[model samples]
Target: MSTTTHETRIDVDPDVPLVRITREFDAPPAKVFRAHTDPELVARWLGPRGLEMSIDHYDCRTGGSYRYVHRRGDEEYGFHGSFHEVRPDELIVQTFTFEGEPDGVALEKLVLEDLGDGRTRLTSTSLVDSFAARDAFVASGMEVGVREGYERLDEVLAQG
Candidate 1:
């Protein structure tokens, strides 16, 4: 069995307002894509290890919108977004905004590629409005969250 560690890549360009992440899953593209598009699956592995995620509403189709909250103890962080385009098992484009800083919105795009022998590669790009916003994201310890999230996803895949 192929392991799912040391293959995740998180890249932040020094000159651009963008963040790119690439990771491979030991599962088929369909299953991997479903994990991304499904709210229940997202909650299972989307954030840091200790936070609990609650979905207010999630619709993964084009023109659809979603809102969710992450709670850790008494503190809660809310995020909401609109799905701009969705192509099953292939690509997703969306607008993401954290509620506390409503004006900082990012355009996010994700692409899934099928690799033979039940493996999938997922690449995600987030385009912020400004360099400061992108830098803020990098400074937010996103790498740890992302790496841990992928580890959680590996566990989820192993269960099925």
Candidate 2:
């Protein structure tokens, strides 16, 4: 269960307001899905490694909403999202918003593909309002958070 063995791919569409991220996990879809849907599991591995995450509320179901904060020393970043659709071990569609940028709401879809042999491929696509918004997101050092977060997730999955 080495983090360096897995690769996380991030693609930013030049002509569209979309970002696609794909990653493979050694665990099954059910395990990865639970890590996403379960609030406690999510809190364990959802951001940069050194940030402490706290969930104000997390309801990962259809029509539910969630709010969480990531804190690093004196700084805190808040994020909230609404779950539009949630299908067990298959898909999740949600709206994501960073509290700091209220105007940049993005619709996100997460799909889990079972790759057999207890492996799963997780693909997430985020559609924002405009290309500018997407560009800003890509320029915001998001890759660090995403890569480190998935590495942490790998550790969590290995523990199970």
TM-score of each: 0.94, 0.97
Angstrom error of the Cα, residue 98, model 1: value is 1.2
Tens digit per residue, CA lDDT, model 2, 26-121: 999999999999999999999888999999999999999999999999999999999999999999999999999988899999999999999999
Between which residue pairs do clashes occur in model 2?
Answer: none
| Residues 1-160 of candidate 1: C-alpha lDDT, one tens digit per residue | 4445647798887888999999988899888878888988989988789999999999999999999999999999999999999999999999999898899999999999998899888999999999999989889888888889899988877767
Worst 10 residues of 1 by lDDT: 1-10
All models, RMSD in angstroms: 1.6, 1.1
Weakest ten-residue segment in model 2 by summed lDDT: 1-10
Alpha-carbon runs more than 4 Å astray in model 1: 1-3
Deviation of model 1 at 7, angstroms: 2.5
lDDT of each: 0.90, 0.95
